[model samples]
Target: MPTITTADGTEIYYQDHGQGRPVVLSHGWPLCSDAWEHELKVLADHGYRAIAHDRRGHGRSTRTSAGHDMDTYAADLATLVEALDLTDLAVVGHSTGGGEVVRYAARHGAGRVTKVVTAGAVPPVMLQSPANPEGTPIEAFDGIRAGVLADRSQFYQDLAVPFFGANREGSTVSQGQRDDFWRQGMLAGLQAAYDCVKVFSETDFTEDLKALDVPILIAHGDDDQIVPIAAAAYRAIDLVRLGTLRVYPGAPHGIVGAYQEAFLADVLEFLAD
Candidate 1:
């Protein structure tokens, strides 16, 4: 049970495996580091120092009510990096974690981060606004918040469909995958999970993207239902200083697992470059 205490005294549980250039993984909303089991094992087997942590109120970490925003999420990650003295890093983030990595580089500086991968990440803003008229509407996020409060169990069960494209024609998403997703969602604190909806949706990462200096690999499934490509990864590549795009045709937001081999190969290749 390896852990680190945040400035606010929240204990974050993390996994550190293998030994080589550190590759820290940041996960998405309502998911803990275990969601990254495949990646952790694979990256380590490939000869990299793989690491992941349970964000506050998610997984085995402190279920605190406050500090569920992107700033705090990034700060917590910083705490882990500094505590471990990790350097020359390759950081990977998914969904809301995508916003976290962007914020992390911007706020703490990318001097140590050598490379970054954001798969199915949310960035450059996900909310609908006058300037970003093509974004998802506020009501959709509100509905999410409402779902968390109303019936989170059922909501998670239902959400696994769109999140993983389980309902898509000829989809291979398994019942175990959906059940595991539900299990992870249930572990999160109700308050933290509820608060994160706003963090992922409303928190604009436009300036954060502009501020990041490291070379980033922007990977996303073309048909991602959670974070649309046009509003997220597609537009995010244009905003970053140096970015490469890898689009998975007809894949869903969970492409990292859904297309595991391809995603792993792509990440390893980018990190090696």
Candidate 2:
């Protein structure tokens, strides 16, 4: 369980394995480094240095009461990469983790990073405004916050339903997958989890997308119920200077876990390019 102390003194837990080029992974909201277990093994086995870290208040990382915003999330990731002296890094982020990588590239530039992959991620923006009318309503995000405050445990359990597409008519995910999602969500700090709802839904990454220099692959599920394709990856692809959009037909927000083989193969192919 290797950990790095951020400038703010938060103990960020990370996993570094294998050798060769580094493939850094950032997990989704309320999830941790463990969320990338499938991707990690594949990357490591394929001769890539796989690295995944628990965001500030998730997983085995220290549960701080503050800095649960995108700026801090990106900074923490930057600190980890810098500390490890990793070069030509291929940053892959899922859901909220996508926002983290986009912000990192925008804020820090792509001197060390070579490419990026955002899978089932939130970027550009998720919330509706006068400018971006296609965004999800603020009330929808408010409902998420209300759900978290009401019962953190049950809220996470309920979220796992659609998260893994279990609510669909012909879901490919198993009960164990939903249970695993619940376990990871419950492990996150209550405050950080609640705060992240705002971070993921409200934070704008439009400028970040515009600032991207390195090649970026925007991956999303066409059937994703959590982050709609039309509002997320579709719009994100148009913003990046060097971007490619790949849709996983009939996949869910948790596609990385549900469609592990395809997801890994798609990413490996993108990294090879």
TM-score to true structure, per model: 0.98, 0.97
- Per-residue lDDT of 1-273 in model 1, one digit per residue for the tens? 999999999999999999999999998888999888999998999899999999999999999998988999999999999999999998899998888888887887467787888989989889989888879999999999999999999999989899998878978888898898899999999999999999999898888888778899999998899999999987898898989999988889875454767888989899988
Q: All predictions: root-mean-square deviation over Cα?
A: 1.0, 1.1
The digit string of per-residue lDDT tens for model 2 on 1-273 reads: 799999989999999888999989999988998889878888999999999999988999999988988999999999999999999889999999999998997897468988999999999899888877878999998998898888978888899888888888888787787888889988899899889999999999998999888999999988888888888998999999999888888898996444667888889999987
TM-score of 1: 0.98
Scored against the true structure, residue 94 in model 2 reaches a CA lDDT of 95
Off by over 4 Å in 1: 256-258
Positional deviation of 23 in candidate 2, in angstroms?
A: 0.9
Task: Give the lowest summed-lDDT range of ten residues in model 1.
Answer: 254-263
Model 2 stretches astray by more than 4 angstroms: 256-258
Error of 2 at 6 (Å): 0.8
